[model samples]
Target chain A: MMGLRLILEQVSHAYRDLSVLDGITLTAAPGEVLVLVGPSGCGKSTLLGIMGGMLAATGGTVSVTGEVAADCLNPLTYVFQDFALLPWRSVAGNIDLVLRARLPKAERQARIAEVLALTNLTEFAGAWPRQLSGGMRQRVGIARALAVRPACLLMDEPLSALDAQTRDLLLDEFAAIIARAGTTTVYVTHNLKEAVRLGHQIVVLSRRPGRIRATVRIDRALTDRTARDPDLLVIGEELWRMIRDDAAAAERERVDAPA
Target chain B: MPRLEGPVHFRAAGFAPKDRAWASAATLLGLLAMWQASASFGLIKSLFLPPPVAIATALWHLTVSGELWKHLSASLMRLFVGWTLGTVFGVGMGLAVGLWSALRSPGMAIVAALFPIPKIALVPLFIIWFGIGEGSKIATLAFGVFFPTVIATAGGVDNVARGLIRMGQSFGLSTGAIVRGIILPGALPAILSGFRVTTSIAIVLLVAAEMIGAERGIGAFVLSAGNLYDTDNLLAGIVVLSVLGLIVAWIIGRLERALLSWR
Candidate 1:
C-alpha cells in the first residue's frame, strides 16, 4: 500500500497584525520523512500546527492523501515537545486512548502490545508519566501517535526538551521504529544534526514570515553508511550554514521592524 | 555536669507513629481531667459546664430511656435527605457551569450573590413557605449544604490542567469522552474536599433548623431540657450533637480518601 502524502499551496497565516507564515508551499511524498528546520520564531511550529489541524491557515489549501478535508483520512496526530502524556494515565493507558475509538478490544490490546514492544516500553506499561525520564516520556508520545495508525505524524520539536545524551539515544531508536512502520512523518526541529540524522529530505524555512528556503535530499547517504558516516556530517554542516544565515537575516528584520 | 543522654539518642526527635499516638492520647486525657476538676471545684457553674463524668452518666440515663435514640434518628434522617439531594444538584450544576462559558458567566453571578447570605436567614422564609415541619428543616439544611459543594466543584473543575485537555484532544477523543475521562477524574480531589466541608455544614444547619420550630430532634430536646432546667439532659444533648458532627466528618474524610486514592 502507498503511504500518505501532504501538499500545501500558498499557505499563509497571521496572528492579528503580525504575519507568521507567508505564502509557504511544499509537498512530501508517501513514506518520506520531511524535516522542517529553521530558527526560533520561524513559524515552523505554527505551520506544523496548521497541518495537524490544530490551527487554521489564514489563506491557501492543504490536502492529505490527494484529498482536501477528506473524512476518510484521519486527522493528523501530533507528538508534542512536552511529551504531553496525561498525568493520570499509565504508559499503556496513554497509548490505548488513541486506539480505543478506532479499534476493537482484542485489536486494541494487540496494537498496544506491539507499540510498547516497538518503543522498548514493555516494562513501563504500568508506570506513570512522572516516573519516566524525558526520553522515555517522548517515546510514549511516539507510541501514542503510532497506536492511532494515522496517515501522517506531525512532530513539533519532539526531542528539543531532552538532554544531549538522551536525544542521541532516542534518535537512534526513533529511526529504527520509523523504518519498521514506514509512516510519513513531518518532524520539526531547529537542530541541524537531528535533521541530517532523521530526515530523508530536509525542508529549510526562513525566519518569521517563513518561506521554504531549500529542500535537500539526504536519503541516499543516510541509507548507505553507519551512524558516524562522513557524508552525514557533510550534509549536516551544509544544512547548518543555510539555517544560520536565515537566522541572522531574521534577527535583523526583527530589530528593524517597529515594536 | 554528667550527660543525661541514654544510648546517645541518634534517631530524630521528630514525631513518629508511636510518639504521635502517645501525644494525642495525653492531650485528650488532659482535657478530660481539666473538665472534671473544674466541675468538682465549681470554677464554672456545673449547670453550664458539666463534668465529663456527669455528661457520661446523663448519656447513660438518656440511652436507657431511649430518648437519645429517638431525637438522634430524627436529626439523622433530615441530614441524610438534605445532604444527598444537595450533593447531587450541586455537582450537576457545578459541572455544567464549569464546562460551558454560556452557563458559567451568568450562573456564577447568581451563585456568588446568594452563597454568602446566611442560609439560616432563609429559614424563617422557608418556615412560612413549607410550614414549621420536617419540610422546612430539611429545606434549610439542603440549602446550607448546596452552596459550598457547588462552589468547591466549580473551582475544582476550573483548576483542571489545560495540558491534560489538550493531551486528550490529541488522542482524538470526542468532546464528551475528554470531559468524562480527563476533566472529571482530575477534579475529583477538590470536589471530595468540598463534600467533606459541606457534610459538617449540613449537620450544623440540621440542628439549628430543628431547634427553631421542631418538636423532635436533639436540638429540640436540648431546648426542652433548658425550659425545665434539667442541666444534665441539656449537657447530654450538646454532647450527642458534638459526637454526631465528629462521626459525620470522619465518614466524609474516609470517603474522600477512598475516592481520591489515585491522587
Candidate 2:
C-alpha cells in the first residue's frame, strides 16, 4: 500500500498574540518517518497537529497528496503522548473502538487481533488499561492506531511517559513496526536518540516561535539502526548541540516564570 | 557490617484504617442491647424512646395487619416514579448543558438559582399547582431530585478527559458514537455516585410531601402516630425509612461494582 504524502507550505500558528509556530515548511514523504525534534515550547506538537488537520494553521496551508488504501478508516491518526486508552475499555475493546464504526464484526475482530499481535499484546486483549503498566498501555495505543491502517500516522512523544528501560524496548519495536508498515509517519519528540534511531528525516525547531532551525537527513533503514552505533550516536550529539542553547535558555526561563 | 537499625521505627504503619463488618454489626447490636436494658430497668420511660423490643413488636403487628405494606408501597411508588422522572430529565439536560457551549451558561445559571431553594418549603406552593394528592407528592420529590442530579451529571461530564474525546475525533468516530462510546462511560462513575445523593434527597422529599398531605405513606403514618402519642408505631416507621435508605444504597453499590469493575 502506498502511503499518503503530507506537504506543509510555509504553515504558521499563533495563540492569539503569542506566535507559537513561524513559517514552518516541511514534507513527510510517502513511506518515510519525518521526526520533529526540538526544545520545550517549540511547537513540535503544534506542527504535528497542523499536519494531521486536527488543528488548522493560522497561516499558510497543509495539503495531502498520493493515494490511501481503500480500507483505511482514518488517513491521519494520532498516537498521543498520554496513551489515551479509555480506562473503561479492555485492551482489545480499545482497539476495536476505532474499527467498530467502519468494519463488520468479523473484520473488526480480525483487525484487532492483527494489531494486537503486531504490538505483542495478544495475551493482553482482555486486560483493562489501568491493570497494565505504562509500556503496556502504550502498546494498546499503538495497536489502536494501527487497527485503522492509517495512511499517515502522527505520533506525539508516545514514549515520553514510559521509563527508560521500557522506552528503549518500545523504541526498537516502533522502528520494526514503522519499517514493516512503511506508512508515512510524522513523529514529534525532544529525544535526539529517538530521532536518530527512527527518523528518515529529522527537523530541529527553535525555541518559542518554533522555526525550522536545522534539518538532518538519515538514509539508514529504521530497523538496522541501533543505540550504540557510532554514526547515529554522533548524529544524536550533533542534534543536541544544535538545540543546547535554546534548551538551557528555555529551562531557566521556565524556572523563573510563574506556573 | 552495619545493618538498618531497629526495623526503621516502623513509621509507615497506621493511617490505613480498614472497614470491619463484624465491628460495625457489633457496635449496632451493643447500642441496641444497652437501649433495651435501659428500657427494661425503667431508666427511660417507654413513652419517650419505646425501646427496640416495643418498636419490633409494633412492626410485627403492622406487618401482620398489612398496614406497613400499604404505607411502604405508597412511599416506594412515589420514590420510584418521582426519582425516575427527575433522573431522566436531569441526565438529558445535564448532557446538553455540559456538551453544548450555548446551553452551559444559561443552564447552569438556572440550576444554580433553583437548586438552593428548599424543596420542602415549596410543597404548599406545589400543592396549589399540582393539587393536594399524589400529584403534589411526586412533584415535590421530582423537584427535589432534579437539581442535584443535574449538578452531578454536568460535573461528571466536565471531568471526562479532553484527551479521550480528542482521540475519538482523531479516529473519525461520529459525534453520536463518541458520546455513546466515550463520554457516557467516562461520566458514569460520577453519575452513579450522584444517584446515591439524589435517591436520599428523593426519600427526604417523599417523607415531607407525604407528611404534609398524604394519608397512607410511612411519613404520614409516623406523623399521625406521633400526634396520637404512640411512640412504638412512630419508631417503627422511622426504622422502616432507615432500612429503605440502606437498601437503596446497597443497590447503588452493586451497580457501581457491575458497571465500574474496570476501575
Candidate 3:
C-alpha cells in the first residue's frame, strides 16, 4: 500500500463571514498517520476535508506531492464519522459500490472478498448496515475505504460514534489495519487517547477559527505503543493540558451564546 | 429507599401493535353475514340494499356470461397504461428537479401551481382536448397520478442523506452511477409509498372517466344498473371495484416487501 505525501500551505476557511479555520499548515508524510486533535467546533473535520480535496480551502492550497500506487482507485478516500454507509446495501455490496465503476465483475468480487477479510467482515458479507452494531458498521466503513486501496485515508472521528467499550475495542483494530495498509492518513478526533494510539505526529489546534497550537511527535512504532506505556500516558497528559482551558472556554461559549 | 425494592413494573409494555389477518377477515365476513340476515328477515328492502347472496348470484351470472371480463379488461388496461405513463414521466421530472439547481425552483413552482387544482375537476377539459375516447379516459387517470408522484419522488430524493452523497463523491463515483446506485435506492421507499396513493387516484379517475363516457367499463355497468334500478347488479359492480382495490393494495404490499427487505 504505497501512500502519498499531503502538503497544506497556510490553509484557511470561513463559512460566509464566520471564520472557522485559519492558516493551518501541516504535512502528512508518506505512509504515516497524522492525527488532528482539537476542541469541538475547531474545524478539524473541515481541515481534513480540505486536505482530502473534498472541500477547497478558502485562503490557501492543499496538494498531494508523491506517487500514487497503480492499483489505487481513489487517491484520497474518507471514512466518515457517521459511517456514511448505504443502508440498502449489504456489507459486501457497500464495498462493491465504490469498486463497480473502476473494476470488472470478477475483480470487483475479488476485491470485495479481500477487504471483507481484511476488516474481519467476511462472515457478515450479506448483512445490511442497519442490522449491524455501530462498531461493526464503522468496520464496514473502514473496509469500504480500504477496498479502494487509497493512496491516503482521511478519517473523521470514525470511532467517536460508538459506545466507550466498542470504541476501545475498535481503536486497536483500526491501528492494526492502518499499520498494515501503511496509507497516509489524516485522522481527526477529539480523543487524545486515540491520537496517542494511532498518530505518528499529533497536531493540536486552538478553538474556533482554529490555529495550530502544538505538534507532538511519537517515535514509537504504532504496533509497539500501548495504553499503559509511561511515555504515551505523559504525552496524552500534555495534550490534555494544551487543550483543557480552550475546551472549557468553548463549552461555556456554547452554553451562553444566543442561538 | 431500600434500593427501590420490589419488582419493577413493566412500564414499557404494550405500545407496539400487531396485525391479525384472521381478525380482519372475520370482521368483513361478520358484517356481510349480518347484512344477509337483515335482508332475509325483511328488515331492509332488497331493492334498496341487495343481500350479499343476491350480489354474489349477480356476480356469478356476470362471470358465466363473460361480462365481468370485458369490463375488467378495459378498466385494467386503462389503469396499467395510465399509471405506467404517469410514473415514468413523473419520476423523470422528479429526478431532474431533485438533482439539478437549475431545474429545482422552476420545476417545484410549476408542480405547486398545478398540483392543488383537483385533477377530477379537469376531466371535462381533458375530454374536450383528448376527445371522448380511450385518450380522454387514460389522460384523466394519468393526470390524476402525476402530481403526487412528483411531490413524493422529489421529497424522497431530498431526504437521501447528504453524507452518503458526499461519500460517493469522495470515492469518485461518477455522477450517473451516484444517481442510479445511491440516489435511486435511497429514494425508492418514498417513491413506492407514493405509488400507493397514485394507484388509488388512478382507479378513482378511471371510474369517473368511464362513467362520463365509456360504454363498457365497471363504472358504466354500475351506472346503467343504477339507472334500471337493478340493485343486485349495482352492488355486484361495487364489489368488483372494492376487490380490485384490495388486489392492487396486496400487489403493492408484496412489492414493498421485496424491494425493502433491508428495512
Root-mean-square deviation per candidate: 5.7, 2.1, 1.9
Model 1 gets an lDDT of 0.84
Worst 10 residues of 3 chain A by lDDT: A1-10
lDDT of 1 by residue, A1-259 (tens): 5577888899999999889898988887777789999987889999998887778999998888733232222447788998877777899988877676667899888888988988989999999888899999999999888877767888889999999999988888877777776778899998877888888889988888888888999766334434577888899888888888778887787788898
DockQ (Cα-based) per candidate?
0.37, 0.88, 0.86
Top of the candidates by TM-score: 2
Per-residue accuracy of model 3 over B74-113 as CA lDDT, tens digit each: 9999999999999998998888899999999999999999
Provide chain B TM-scores across all predictions.
0.89, 0.97, 0.95
DockQ of 1: 0.37
Model 1 scores a TM of: 0.87
* Cα lDDT of model 3 by residue, A1-259, tens digit: 3569999989999999989999988899998999999998999999988888789889998888888888999999999999999999999899999999789999999989999898889999999999899999999999999999999999999999999999999999998999889899999999999999999999999999999999999987789977677888899999999999999999998999999
Range of the 10 consecutive residues with the lowest summed lDDT in candidate 1 chain A: A66-75
**Local accuracy of candidate 2 as per-residue lDDT tens digits, B133-250:** 8999999998988888899899999999999999999999999999999999999999999999999999999988999979999999999999999999999999999999999999
Candidate of highest lDDT? 2
Weakest ten-residue segment in model 2 chain B by summed lDDT: B2-11
Candidate 1 local lDDT, B42-80, one digit each (tens):
887877877889889999989999989999999999989
Of the native A-B interface contacts, what share survives in model 3? 0.86
